[model samples]
Target chain A: MKLYNYFRSSASYRVRIALALKGLDYDYLPVHLVKGEQSAAAYASVSTSHLVPTLLDGDAAISQSMAIIEYLDETHPQPALLPADALGRARVRAIAQDIACEIHPLNNLRVLRYLTHDLKLSEDDKNRWYRHWVESGLEAVERQLAAQPGRFCHGDAPTLADCCLVPQIFNAQRFDCRTSHVPNVMRVFEACMALDAFSQTQPSACPDAA
Target chain B: MKLYNYFRSSASYRVRIALALKGLDYDYLPVHLVKGEQSAAAYASVSTSHLVPTLLDGDAAISQSMAIIEYLDETHPQPALLPADALGRARVRAIAQDIACEIHPLNNLRVLRYLTHDLKLSEDDKNRWYRHWVESGLEAVERQLAAQPGRFCHGDAPTLADCCLVPQIFNAQRFDCRTSHVPNVMRVFEACMALDAFSQTQPSACPDAA
Candidate 1:
């Protein structure tokens, strides 16, 4: 398997964490988003969406980090990323989507560029936009965690939610988003970071990290 | 099952189509997003993220439309939303996320509000932001669909991708995004809209739709 991804992309970070958790080996093919390498014609064949963290398994190429993660879990069943039961899977997926859909999309590099360049927002305003989504989105995750009350996002084991939470928290801290209010979320982040899968595959640990 | 959702919400409409496709009955408990009902204390208890398209099944309150749809699919196996094979499922999910994560999140109400209200962009600038994501995002979907030509987004059956695609197309048309660029996507949209599951559960057909 060859994973085409960027170092700092939260979505790429997610697939990295999932791969590490499953103890899978893959060649890391870095696509630099800042340099606009993702827009090149060569990268477009790998990913129609021109997004990072596309997993190429033999002849098959899977885009979308969540879908890639799910594909990994489905193919490699042991140490499941989702829960065994349907309801449990729903809870974990809900939490994952809470971050993947609600927060990270708004604060991604392209959106920030659009804010600063197209909309003519100042650097301060751009940072403010970044912080706004992260802070409020984490608060919601905090509420969900408080309700569940586990060592990880779902249970004793780190599931898909943890895979998503850890990366978003990393991005949050990178932008200096307010984390004080969401103690439960922060606690989970700490627990996740303690794991080798998360710590070793984080953005900075990637080959292309600036 | 009771679905606490808003009419015209792409996420909500996605779940509605999923339920309708499965031939399952769900109570449509409308949460008017435009009326600020999603931010209420009552809603916060139901959805930690305070987002629409939260499905309440017995005691379990599942948030996130993708999660809800997956949960529904899990419990009701016939007329499955995902493909039988792992690789096939990955393809369907990638198409779904191409819209859900990439396009729909940007054009959603709160983000648009943040653009016009917080960033103070003119109406035209806000619409430009909306069209930019939709047009570009749909073009990506078009490329994916062209690669995997079928009667629907996946095969002859309307999988999760079609559920996501139809609502997004509705929103694109509502906002007058450039639909002509993506003929394959529009072709699938036409194919999906022909189905009762897609047409009957659409935004305009909903009880709360204005």
Candidate 2:
């Protein structure tokens, strides 16, 4: 298996954590987002959107970190990323999407670039935009996490929600977003980081880390 | 079952199509987004993020349109929203997320409001922002669709991809985004709209349609 990723990408970090949790080994291939390597012909062939963290398993190339994680869970089926029950699965997915869909999408490198370059916003304004979405989005996650009190995001086991949460928190801290209010979210982030699976696969641990 | 939805919300439309596809009856409780009704305390009690398309089934209140659709597919299970096979499911989900994550979130009302009010982009610039993301994202969707030429998004039958595609195209049309480049996506949109599930649940057909 081969994973095309960038060190700082939250979505790429997600797939890395899932891979580590499942104890699966893969070739770590970096697609540098900052250097515009993702748009180069080489990377674009693998990912239509020119995004990082496209996983190649034999003939199949899966884009979208959530989809790749789901594919991993289905094929491997151990240390399941999703819960067994239907509603449990929905809650976990909702939490994951809460981050993946709501928070991360708004603050991704491309969107941030658009804020500064295309929209011509000042650096301070750009940072303000980033912190606003990340802070508010995490507050929602904190509320949801409060509802389902657990060692991890859903249960004692780290599911997809935790995989997503850790990266977003990493991003939140990077942007200096205020997260002191969301204690439940911070607790889960801490718990997930204690495990080697999450810690060893984080941005700073990646081969491409600056 | 009860669905807290907004008439013109693409996410809400996705859930409405899923409910129609599954032939499940749901009470359509309108949450007027443009009017700022989604942020009201009453809606916030049901959804922390205050986003529309919150599905209330028994005691479970699921937010996020994709999660709600997946829940419906799981509990009901008659017309499966996801494909049976793992790879197929991944493909379907990737397609759905391509639109739900990439295109819609950036073009949603709140994001547009932020662009205009906070960033102070001109109205024309705001429309350009909307059209830019929608067109480019649809081009990516078109590439994925072209790779796997199905009558619908995945195969002959309507799956989660189609559920996401129709609503997104509806949004694109609303914003006057260019669709000529993506013939496959437009074809799929038309095919899905021909079905009652997509047609009847569209914004204009909704009881709360303005």
Q: Per-residue lDDT for A1-210 in model 1, tens only? A: 999999999899999999999999999999999999999999987888888989999999999999999999999988899999999999999899999988998889898898888888899989988999999889889999999799999999999899999989889888898999999998989999899999999988999988
| Per-residue accuracy of model 2 over B1-210 as CA lDDT, tens digit each | 999998899999999999999999989999999889999999989997789989999877999888888889989998888989988999899999999899888989998898889888899999988998999899989999998898999999999999999989988898899999999999999999899999999999999998
Q: Candidate 1, TM-score vs. the true structure?
A: 0.99
TM-score of each: 0.99, 0.98
Q: Give the alpha-carbon lDDT of every model.
A: 0.92, 0.92
- Go through the candidates in order and give the C-alpha RMSD of each one to the true structure: 0.9, 0.9
Candidate 2, residues A104-206, lDDT tens digits: the string is 8899988889878987889999999999899888888988989879999999999999989999999999889998999999999999999999999889988
Give per-residue CA lDDT, model 1, range B40-135, as digits (tens): 988887888889988999998998988888899899988999999999999998999999998998999999898888878899999999999999
What are the candidates' individual DockQ scores?
0.87, 0.81
Q: How far off is residue B37 in model 1, in Å?
A: 0.7
